[model samples]
Target: MADGDKTIEISMDRARLDLDYCYDFIAASYWSAGRTRGEFDRSVEMSFPVGAYCEGRQVGFARVVSDQIAIAYVADVFVDPDYRRMGIAAKMIDALHSHPELKRVKRWLLATADMQPLYRLHGYADLDDMMMMRLDEDARNRDPLR
Candidate 1:
């Protein structure tokens, strides 16, 4: 669970997640600036979430939505400003891809406005023209707890 320095610990245990730390960091993030607490909590409840820590204090977080059979979508990968570039994010992603429940997944997907190079280490590539998405303009207005 420790990174190269062995000072960081990464955990997939849902109970170990620090909600207060995660919500505060993600709420102000450019990608999820307006995300509600309920939405964040629901996401954690439904997904295989991972947290990176140092000395028992959380420093990073990521999650993967998967079926435990095949296919996975990686999202919400955030490392604290003071903890970036320490291979924490990579370790979290590796934890997901190599986790016993998801190692067999054939396809993994994620979207990042920047930071492509960081993901490249995990075998993520540029999307092909065939890839597409449809949006729900008011999805945010929808209740996540519902």
Candidate 2:
């Protein structure tokens, strides 16, 4: 599909991913500050990656970590600053939701600091009744190899 004079394509093909752009964007994000390129690459390798391209240049991205049946975690969703406000992010999310492999997922989860409104528009609601917990970073830091 074309957005204005730019042709936009959202695809599931990992080969189309621009790793440098993705890693740079994610590493600068508030949630993933200090994330290494190796870590980002590993995560992309393990997930269902979606790339949004405008005029053959990657302008947006998202990844879904899923078991292909029960649940999926959407992560690292972003649109290049120059491409914002043009509905690219929403289109990427729509592509993910329509993916056949994720059609049977019973649950979808994502954590966003300030994008609740956007997610809510996509049918995600705050899990107000559920307790969300995380292992302390100290526990992770204590691991010898980590």
Candidate 3:
């Protein structure tokens, strides 16, 4: 959803995803830097991917890793710089929640240095008591070939 001429359309189908655009954005992103196209494709294949398109070109993307039962881990949420603040991310999350396989999911998790307010609207609270711990190294120091 956008204000003016730029109307964003959300698609849940992985086949509709713009591989080059999504892979390029993730490859250069701070949180997912050095990720190869093959790895990105595999992730998309295994997860539920959402794409936001503007006039046919992909402008935003997000994905959820879930077992279709207990929990869903939302990840790789990235909106193109030009398409930010227009509710694309929120709409992606909405699509995830309304999805047939995920509508009944009891738990949802995501990690972000910022954007708490956005997730809060969806009832995600700060996990102050038990934080999400990761085993991998920081994305910035990670090797592309590793």
Candidate 4:
């Protein structure tokens, strides 16, 4: 954790997990996806999540939804606006891709509106037959906390 340069830390350690800071960072930086604190908390609770830090601050994050067998989806990746282009998210993803828990996964998937080049560097490509769909907001709103 230097002035502008930073190192990433990985933790399943509950004491080291900054759930509040992570929630705030995602809420402020990502609006198009309209993510909320509860969604962030639930994802971490249910999946393999990694949070990226810059100068001891939560800045970027992503998670893997996998059985560590056939499929792994990389989701909810975002970096703070002030720290963009510093390669923090790339490093975070690289760490996860190389993680031992993820070694068994044969297929990695991600949905990105941009950043295709970054993913391609790690051997991800366009899936021709795959189509993605989501439930309506009203349907999603059925859950009191989403």
| lDDT (Cα, tens digit) per residue for candidate 3, span 36-122 | 889999999999999999998999999999886667898999999998889999999889876776655667888887777788787
Reference-based lDDT, each prediction: 0.79, 0.79, 0.80, 0.65
Per-model TM-score on C-alpha atoms = 0.82, 0.83, 0.84, 0.71
Let me know the TM-score candidate 3 reaches against the reference structure. Answer: 0.84
lDDT at 61, model 3: 92
- Candidate 1 TM-score versus the reference: 0.82
Superior candidate under TM-score, 3 versus 4:
3
For model 2, state the Cα shift of residue 11 in Å. 1.0
lDDT by residue for model 1 over 1-146, one digit each (tens)? 44465498889988999999999999998789779999999998999999998987999999999775446788898999888878899899888876766655667778887777777766777785323122223333433422
Clashes of each: 0, 0, 0, 0
* Per-residue lDDT of 84 in model 4: 70
What would the per-residue lDDT of candidate 4 be over residues 1-146, giving only the tens digit for each residue? Answer: 33344655544344456788667766766332587677778877877877766556677677788776556788777777776787767777777776666665666777776677777676777664332222122222232221
Candidate 2: clashing pairs of residues:
none
Give me the candidate number with maximum TM-score: 3
RMSD of each: 9.2, 9.9, 10.1, 10.3
Per-residue error at 12 for model 4, in Å?
5.6
Clashing residue pairs in candidate 3 are none
Cα shift from native, residue 74, model 2 (Å):
0.5
Off by over 4 Å in 1: 1-6, 128-146
